[model samples]
Target chain A: MRNHNVTIGIFIVSGLALFTLVLFTIGNEHKAFSPHVDLHTEFANISGLTKGSDVQVAGFDAGEIADIEVPKSPSGRFRLVLRIDQRLNPLVRTDSLVTVDSEGIVGDKFVQIHGGSANAREAAASTTLPSKEPLSLADLLESSNDLINGANGTMKGVQGKLDGTLDAATKTINNANDLIVGIKQGKGTVGMLLRDQTTATEIQQAVANGEQATVSVKQASASLKHASGQADALVSDFASRGLGGKVDQTLLSARGAAGNLDSISGQLHQTMTEALGEDGRGVDAGGNIQQSLSNLTETTGNMAADTEALKHEFFFKGFFKHRGYYSLADLDPTTYRNDRVFTNPDNGRAWLEAARLFEQTSNGQERLTTEGKLQIEEAIAELGDGALNGPLVIEGYSSQSDSGTQLAASHSRALLVLHYIHARYQVDLRNIGAVALRNTPPPGVHKETWDGVCIMALKASS
Target chain B: MIGIFDFVGAVGLFGLRVIGSVFRIPFELEQIWRHIGEAGVRSLALVLSAGLALGVVMTLHTRGALVMFGATAMIPKLQSLGFFVEIGPLVAALLVAGRVGAGNGAVLADMRATEQIDAIEALSMDSFKFLVVPRVVACVIALPLLTVFMDFCGILGGYLSEYTLSHISLHLYLTRAFQGMQWSNFVPPTLKALVFGFIIGTISCFFGYTTNEGAEGVGRAATSSVVVSSLLIILADVILVKIIFLTFPGSAT
Candidate 1:
């Protein structure tokens, strides 16, 4: 029984030994008992990296860290050693970058590798690849400190600028407000200009006063103009009537007494001898007296006869010369004055009336005079209707220059001459408005030096 | 000094018996078959239990180590590499050495103390065939099957480990196991286990059949078998790894 037990024990032990072997052998092909490769990476600061952490390429997990071996150098810096799978070695390129990151905000630290340029070579095994230094706590604190300092300085400057600007702005606003109040209170020039009401009252009073003065001026001007017209007509009419009646009587009487004036001159010579008969020498003295008396009386008689002859020739000879010879040429003044019709070579009728008036009234015609005014009106009307497009002359004369002083005689004469024509006679310039504005420059010469006359030529504006 | 001699004498006697047992094994195979049935079938529960337990324990324990490295998905690799090269041979050899080696030694001690082997020798039938050969042959055959069974159990253990400790499902584990890697990874370990089985069985038989110092001698033989077998297993693993790693590292890879 013991021997049998021994054999049983041996078989059991052998089977058990085989069992143990099976476990290991099965694990072997599966790499459970196989050796694994170890690779490492290092960084200046791991940023809370721990062992057995994942290593990723791009986003995929290519391997893990088997161990973290920190080899201390003489300088007391630890060179980190990480064991990684050999399979993942090729994923690490020459320029691949690694960053320390966490799964989430609080997850474990991992090394994330960024794929490098396509042309780069893969990192080899057992190689210590370069690593980027992660931002340390000191760096963060330093940057934050700089930011705070900058912010503080900016705030200080802003505060100071704001203080100065606010004070100046407030003062300026107060001054503006004071100026506005002053204007409301009617102070200074602009304040009064903007707010004063007394100016309006004064202006209304001045307007009423001006109206009264205008009414008086209107009455005075009307009275003066009426008096001037009637007086001028009466004076001119009487002069014309008296001169005509008296001159006619004298001409008729002289024509009738021509023989008697011849007989009286012989009687006056015989009378001179009778007054000398009182003395024997009376005959010689009387003869001398009579001869002297007779010579004086005879000279006076001859002058009277010559004056009558000149009058007859002037009136009758001009009438006869123009009546007998009418041609389109320049004629003598007396003849031209007698005829109002002068013909030009262009077959146009030139009014001899204009020439006659120019000669007759060369001393400036008093258009306001009342003689033959109807005739003047008819001539003006005819001239207008003809639309001759010819120049008409309007003139003015200033009886006074300066303050009755010849000191500025020439200057005032020119100026006053233009002023009178503009103010009085130059009215109705639509028909005839020309002025030969003149100054008494030389002793015998009155030259119209200024001809600044505006001519209104009518045309349609369309 | 005595201890050294005793060990020397023990190894010497063990060698002689092993040679003698080999010559006698074929004739007594029928009787050995009976022993095999008795020892193997009777100890099936224990063998399977111990084998499976060792396999599972080793797989789970080592798989856990691999897991911390995020290598849990490689549980089958763990199982294969471990079972084939180191796990299958060494574990099986040690267990058999401890169990069968002690059993044989005790049996020989009993025969010696009771004069059973002496009596058999006097009958002119080879006592080596009757006592040593049957036991040796029994162990040699049984240990290998046990190792194979253990290999299976180890794979199962790896699957269970991945299931419990990892997110891997049993189906996936088996799918990965049955992948060509299983048969391929199996060839080396099981082959090695055959050698381990022979080594352990022959050593146990040698130590047991050569018992000399009576009851004490049997105890000594049992202890020696275990020690020698364990040592041989280790030595064999080292040499095998060198040859494999050095010559065909690619294969292991």
Candidate 2:
């Protein structure tokens, strides 16, 4: 009986101890005995934020959701009451922002509170905070689609003009490719200069002959000085002694011969100038005065072909008073070459230097130059506004800048050239296309003849 | 079906009679003390062992599930919630029904079968009040206490199992165990034990007090006591849980 009483006592003692432990632990978790403050906020959508979700203040765990209430009114806003630790009450303020957030993408929802300004009053119990609504994936996707559609429309408009420009570029490239093939086969003047050994030897001989002519000119000037001195001495001797009359007559005849040579050189220059129409008044078989000038320029370029050309090249070009007509082709074989434009056939092509056309050095708006006006007139007449072939392409190139930036700048230059051509010739703008290129030449292009320039090229419609 | 209805009706009356005699028993001090020893002290080993085993098993199961979500730290909280809500009350009631209810029923049934109950009546003592009331009162008092004991033991068992896998401090584990629990969580499930005790006591007494088949009836009474009490306790739990949720809305979370 004593043992039974002891057993009962032990049972009662253990049971009460466990009961107390449970109450204490549970009470602590609930903050039942701790001091706390109540905070409130209203949300249009709770997004499954249930009770016990953590309430954080500036990313720190400050509290937990105590209760959620759906008001009696039909507006359907939910009022959430939170139990926060007393220590965190100072951080909460009347103007603080509250938002519902989640742990990760798919984790539990929680209330996040951002502290108000320093001057804002500390929050009282049950202080209300402004709530922010979270953005859904559907909203993000809809905005993205709107952006994509806008870009697609702009790209479509650009693609049409790009296709036309691309076709002209392809044909021009094919012509240049054929030229390269001919040059490689030693079929043209340029090819002969590169590959024909006899032509090379002849060029060496011509250079030698030019050097000899320079030496002869120097010797003749020395001889003229010597003859003048000798004439002075002989005249003195004739006056003083009246001796050697044959020698005196011979000196006078030599002087007469020098005068005749000078006269003959003058006559030769006058005749050549008249033939070439240096005065811009002579017309060739084409009945175009400028056509005659172009032919003369071409003839001047091939100075190795004729005796008159050699004479003009070696002596007359140096002595000529004309400033503009004295081209560098007279002296250097490579200078002032017209091979960059291999064909004319009515439809003309030319590369106008960007620097010569524009006052401003780099990019942007361009001011016209004196040479630019002359070149534009020539290009417009040559293009014929597609009367001979198809559209005229004013392709702009810049090898020194970024492709996109350079292309855009090149496009601006092309547009300027296009406007000039249109204003002068009343050419249809539709029959002109502008192209921009980077450091690389266009398709099938072997070389770039003009860098930082607008190349006005013509192509047949086919 | 008729016998079942008759049995249910008789048990209902017996429950009422126990309630009726509870206040008027003149505080039979010795009998109450002896019954407390029999019902509570005697049942300690079984309750503690079962509670500990249950706690270990539940912890293992919850760990396996929560681990997939990287929520292994939630083991303690889940164990506490499981014990307080379902495991502690139900297990305590069932254990008592098996040990205390069967013992009371078989003892009373044997006395009735052998005419000892009649002899007590002939001696001018109230057999209903003396034999039935103390046992019913003892059960009503002891079950809740034993449930508390079981809940604590189960938490310890869970901690022991958790410790083997990961060394969580005792203080931290206990704190996490009670992280979301409340007085409401503790109250309803503990109060439900009162209903459980009444069901076990009344059903067992009803069977034992009216024993009819002599020695054979004693065995049937003990068997029926465990079976009927367990079924009624489970049925009552369903209703209790609903009432708990309605009365205390956020306690479930």
Candidate 3:
């Protein structure tokens, strides 16, 4: 009987103990036995956060949400009561931000409390913390979709403008190229002056006539000087001879010769001035030769302006872009450095050092030496026989202390190299261009600064 | 149908008499203690074994489903919640009805068939108090305690099964198991076992005490006790669970 009682007692006690253990463990999870404080926060959207969802304080597991109060109106926010452990109370300051967060992409939602700054006071019980409503996935995706659509629209518009600009540029270059080719073929008046044998002979003959006229004028001036000397001698002789008849005749002859010489000299001076402008008044001041040359220059400039205007015209825009030609003069240093034509991976480059390639003239101007011409020929040869098929750009670089000096030096070097290449090799002028890049070389050239020209030949990928 | 109603009416009258006799008597402490040992201590092994077996089976079943959702971590919680809220109390009651209820009925019916109750009544003792009331009270006191044991044992069984599969630590398993639990989830279901205990005790005792047959009736009484008590417990469970949910709505979670 005692044994039976003991077994029953043990059974009852153990069962009750297990029950107590379960209750205590659950109570601990709920913070029922621990000292805690309640905090309040309101949100426009709870985002599936339920009561008893874990509350983390600055990423630390602190407590859980105790209650949620639904608002009476649709516009009103849901008020939440958070029960946080007293040990973490100091971390819950008045300025702490409360937000609803999820455990994972598809996991349960929880309340996240951000720790406030040290300057903020500890939040008292029932104090409402600042809240930010949870952002829904739908809203985020919608906003991103709108942003992508807007960006796509902007890119389309920009692409359209760029295509139009490129087309116009290509058309202008092709037209300019055609015009130059026409002139080279002697198809027009300017072409005739440059290429016609008859016109050339006439120009040579006119030059000879001007030379002869100058020599005649010089002879007239010499005669006048000689006449002045003779008058002085005649006056002396007249005084000595006491106004004899022979002295009077000699004076009249000298006077007649002096007057005739003066007339000849005045006519020569007027003829010279009309043909070859006035002395020290500049070539454009007044003269038939100066005026004709000025008119030609003006006409060429107008033609160039009209060609340049084709780049902006709607009709020729697409044609220009298709040709892929760009004006070297229009490219600044930055643009040249970034331009794909000269920076192409397939393009071959030859670096000619300024000191090796050029020498200073007696007048302090830089010009390419004989060795420089040889170096350019060798660089072109290194690019293979196919170098002449595509465009070649002469990239001029000069490391001068001043920007203006750098630009001038680099431009002079590039122009000299360009002229030498054209004149020496008979290379098509339309196939080559020169650009002054100041001190900076194009990207991928492995140089921080350069003081020379780089002959870049666009080579087709083989 | 008429016979079924007549049987029910007789059982109701017998239950009323038992209730009245329970208050009117000199308290049957010794008998209650002896019956408690018989009903609770002796039944402990069966309850634990069944609890453990059920736990393992439940875990095995739920593990597959939870794994499909990538929620295998919720297996322990599901096991605990399953045992605490419904399985532990109901299964324990049914087991007790089959074991203790049959034992109580058979024992009482043997004494009645052998004229032991008539001998006790001739000596100026209340036979119902000396016999039926003690057995009923013992059941009432023992059932909830058995339920607690079943609940914990089932959880231990689940942990063992889970540990074999996952090599999960005991502390972590226990923590996760109780993480989603609430006081209402546990207390109300455990307390509902009291109603199940009452039904088991009263029906078993009524069947055993009212039996008029001889030795053959003892077997009939035992069989009737188990069937009636188990059925009543199940029926009572449905009502009690509803009442619990109505009283403590949070337990539904």
Residues A317-390, model 3: lDDT tens digits: 66765666576545566777786656766788888999989999899999876567679889888987878776
lDDT string for model 2 (A290-391, tens) is: 678899998876764564464468566544323223321122212212222212233345666667776664554566664676676666555565542445
lDDT of 1 by residue, B1-253 (tens): 9997987687667556665667743667567777676546564555456656665677766766655766555666557556655665566667776777677767777787778888999999778777766776676666566666556666676666566666677667764553324333455555666556566666766666666778788888788777877787677767766665555433454
Q: Give interface RMSD, every candidate, in order.
A: 10.9, 2.9, 2.1
Ranking by TM-score: 2, 3, 1
CAPRI class of candidate 3: acceptable
Per-model TM values vs. the true structure: 0.35, 0.55, 0.54
Q: Write out fnat for all predictions, comma-separated.
A: 0.10, 0.65, 0.65
Candidate 2 segments exceeding 4 Å error: A49-69, A101-110, A115-119, A134-462
DockQ per candidate: 0.05, 0.34, 0.34
Off by over 4 Å in 3: A44-54, A67-75, A101-110, A134-462, B7-25
Candidate 3, B1-253: lDDT as tens digits: 9999998898778878767877875889899888888889888999999999999999988898888878877888889999999999999999999999898788888888999989999999988888888888888889999999999889999999998999999999998888757788999999888877777888888777878699898999999999999998888888888888788766754
Scored by DockQ, the top model is 3
